[model samples]
Target: MTTICVDVMGADKEPAVLLEGVAQALAADTDLEVLVAGAAEFVEPFAASHDRARALVTTEVITMSEHPAQAVRAKKDASIVRAAAAVRAGEADGLFSAGSTGAVLTAATFGVGRLKGIKRPALSLPFPGISGRPTVFLDMGANADVRPDVIVQFAQMGRAYARAVLGVAEPRVGLLCNGSEETKGSEMALAYHEALAAADCGFAGNAEGTDILAGTFDVIVADGFTGNVALKSIEGTGKFVLKRLKAAMGASLKNKIGMALLAGSLKSLAGELSGDEYGGAVLLGLRAPVLKGHGATSARAVCQGTLAAVRVVRAGLTEKIADACELSA
Candidate 1:
């Protein structure tokens, strides 16, 4: 069974919203277990009712206003902190949260700790591609600036992830750049281009932003700044298009019937652009798996995120990454 620690206080909808997702996950998978961290009053009752769920009994929670590192250090009893501690202590297999991104990163880095030789933690998000397989992108927002070694590490870690979780053998890796040419992109992108070329991991040439969802590559390596910007841009455009599409579909009864007839197609298309279908973002280079659902994530997304963590753990992602990457530890 895959036991995961869940931070239930800081989500957009808080304890109630989180419980529903936990319940959904419990109902869906008999092999999955969740230990919810929150006030005793909230978590205890919920855990009592569910067969696979347990209560961590935390009293404090880190909010968005508090600084990430400071709050983690001071709020020892915070939900996120306690959850991470649980994973580190071997009480849980991994960590999952919809709290502040900064808090999640800080907790994972300090509480669960990093793998050997890894100075930074990275956020790797799955981007749905045309091939029905997702292309993973790294350093979504962990570090705005990273060295060449970090970028190289991202590719190595990503390869392990694709193999373990995505079931891809010899995943194709790419460096995100303005152009497909080797001459384009910043010095860092160019540096990794040369580094990956010599590495054993399958390195595809530089890929443009348009190639991200085109199924051009299985892994895209980038600095946090560029990767975050590209991610938000893609999400924003997807939302805009969906909003307009909905408006057009609801314009008239005729369109409604037409859409109803094509509901399956539309739903499939929407799934491709949805955050829920993607199962949130995974924090890489840590001792254990850590997944962060979006702040405004729905109950389904929350459930999917929990399931994603379980999948990663069962796949032995952490072990695979440590073994594949040459670490000092």
Candidate 2:
């Protein structure tokens, strides 16, 4: 059975709401077991009611405002900290948390540990694209600054993610830059371009911001700073477009008729764009998969995130990543 340690605290939503998601996940995946970590009051009752779930009582909770490294160090009994320890100690195959991104990353990196030879673990998420396939993008917010060699490994990690999770065979990789031209971008991008082109991983060349969702590449790698900015920009632009569309649709009775006809398509598009589809971002290059959902995630998102973690464990994602890194080494 695939067991995932779920940290049910630290999210904006109530623990009960996240527990509802755990219940949903358990109902959906009969082969899955969950180690729900949280305060005694919150987890005990829920675990008692669920057959596949067991409670790991935790006393402390990591707040979003606290320094991630310091909080992890001070709060040994914190829910997220304990959850990571469970994964490290073989009590769980993976971990899922909708908590502070920094806390989850810090705890998982230090507690669950990085895979041998991995310089850094990257935060990766599958971006839904126009081509009916999701593009695996990495370094979403792991390392703000990275060297060319690190970027190359990010490319390899992204490729492994695309293949293992997205089921893409021979996934093409791209370096995100200001322009598609080989000569465009800062010295770092140029260095990345040179390294990726020479690396054994599939190198599809430089990808512009537009190519992120244009279905031009299966995987895109960037320094965490740039990747995080690009991700937020895409999300902001999507929201802006949707808001404008809603306004336009409500502007006139004629538009209402048009909206009625397009309602199904629009809903489908919204679902695809919603970050909930993939549950959350996976921290790649770690010894075990660590998924971090949005801080304000809903129960449905939590359920999806739990299932996504299960998928990662079942696919032997970390093993594949280790092999890829070793081969490249």
Candidate 3:
């Protein structure tokens, strides 16, 4: 059986909501078990009700505003910290949390540990594609600054994720930059371009912001700073477009008739665009797979995130990543 340690605290939503997600996950997978960590009021009842779930009964809660490393050090019984410990101790194969991103990353990196030879772990997510399959993007917010060599490793990691999770054979990799030209980037981007070109990993040259969702590249790598900015920009733009569309659809009776005709297709598109469908971001290059859901994630998102973690553990994602890194090295 694949067991995942779930941190049920530190999210914007109530603990009950996350618990409901956990219940949903349990109902979905018979081979899955969960070690839920949270306050006694929340976790005790959950564990008592679900035969597959066990409560860790954490006393402390880490808030989003606290310093990640420091809070992790001080709050030994914090939900996220204990959840990571469970993974490290072999009590769980992976971890899932809708907590502070920084706290989850810090705890998982330091507690669960990085894979051997991995210089830094990356935060990656598979983004829904426009015309083709979802593209795997990495360094979402792990390392704000990285060397050219690290960027190359990101390419290898991204490629491995594309194959293992997204089921892409021979995924093409790209470095995010201002322009598509090899000559069109900052010194770091140029260095990355040169390094990736020489690396064994699939290198498809530079990708612009417009190419992120254009189905032009299977994997895109960037430093955390740039990747985070680009991710937020895409999210914001999507929301903006969605709001405008809603307004336009409700503007006139003629538009309402048109909307009724396209309602089914629109709902399908919304599901694809919603981050919930993909679960959450996975921290690659770790000893075990660790996923972080959005702070305001819904119960469906949590359930999906738990299932995603299960898939990662069952696929032996960490072992595949280690082999990928070793081969590249």
Candidate 4:
């Protein structure tokens, strides 16, 4: 059984909704075990109602709205800290927290430590691809300001993630930039591109923003600033398109019929694009598994995030990341 620790107080929704998600995950995977850190009174009842209150999961209950560092420090019994401690102690294979990205990162940093030669850790997000392949985007916000060398490390990290999550043997990697031209984007990007090209790790040259949704490569690397902008742009475009579709469908009966015919397919497609459906972002190049859930995550997202963490541990991503980082270094 893979033990996964989750910060139950992390999401915008409180223990109620998040705990409900824990229930959902438990229902989906009977072999899995979850250790929730949050209010025990809130979580215990939910566990008891399902009769899983006992052996399937244990509760640690940390409060919401606590300062990231202070909460982790002062709340010796805080859920998030306990979860991190669990990972450090080898009691859990991975940790998931939707509460605060900074807190989660800080806790994981202190709890798990960094991989050899990796100066900064990255957040890796998998985007749905064309032809059903998954594309990975790295440094999504783990480090806002990064050096050229760090971007190269991000590429290697992205490559390892694609291999582990997408099962691509030798994933093609591309640098995210304004244009495909060698001179486009930042000076740092140009230098990093040249570095990756020289290193020989399946680098696929540069990729423009337009190429991301088209899924041209298995991995796309960028500094946190560029990557976060690209991620938000894609997410915003998706939401905007859906809004327009809804408006169009409501305007007339013909459009309504059209939407009715396409609703199921559209839902499946949207699900594929949703961050929630992907579970959460993985903090790469760390000694232990650290999954960061979206702040707006619901119970389903928490449950799925825990599952994703399990897959990360099972993939032996920590070892893969260390190997990749050593090569990149």
Give per-model TM-scores. 0.93, 0.95, 0.94, 0.88
- What is the C-alpha local distance difference test score of candidate 1? 0.86
Candidate 3, 1-329: lDDT as tens digits: 99999999999999999999999999999999999999999999999999899999999999989999899999999999999988999999999999999999999999899888899899998888787678888899899999989998899999988888888889999999999988999988998999999998899999998878877899999999899999888888877877787788889999878878887877666555555678899999989999999887789889999999999888878877887888432
Q: Give the C-alpha miss distance for residue 164 in model 2, angstroms.
A: 1.3
User: How would the candidate models be sorted by lDDT, starting from the highest?
Assistant: 2, 3, 1, 4
- Model 3 poorest ten-residue lDDT run: 267-276
For candidate 4, write residues 1-329 as lDDT tens digits.
77777677756777787777778877887777776666667666665676433322334434346567776666566566667777888777788888777678777887776776888988888888776777888878777788877877888888888887768999999999879887786888888888888775678889988777678888888888888888888888888988899899999999999999999988767666666667888898877889888877677788888788888888888888778777432
Name model 2 segments beyond 4 Å from true: 253-268, 327-329
Q: Which lDDT values do the candidates have, in the order given?
A: 0.86, 0.92, 0.90, 0.77
Rank order (by TM-score, best first): 2, 3, 1, 4
lDDT of 1 by residue, 123-231 (tens): 9988888776689988788999987777888888988998999989889999989999989877778887888788766788898899778877999988899988988
Candidate 4 local Cα displacement, residue 299, angstroms: 3.3
Clashing pairs counted in every model: 0, 0, 0, 5
Check candidate 4 and list the clashing pairs. 10-99, 37-79, 38-61, 38-62, 39-61
TM-score of candidate 1 to 2 decimals? 0.93
In lDDT terms, how accurate is model 4? 0.77
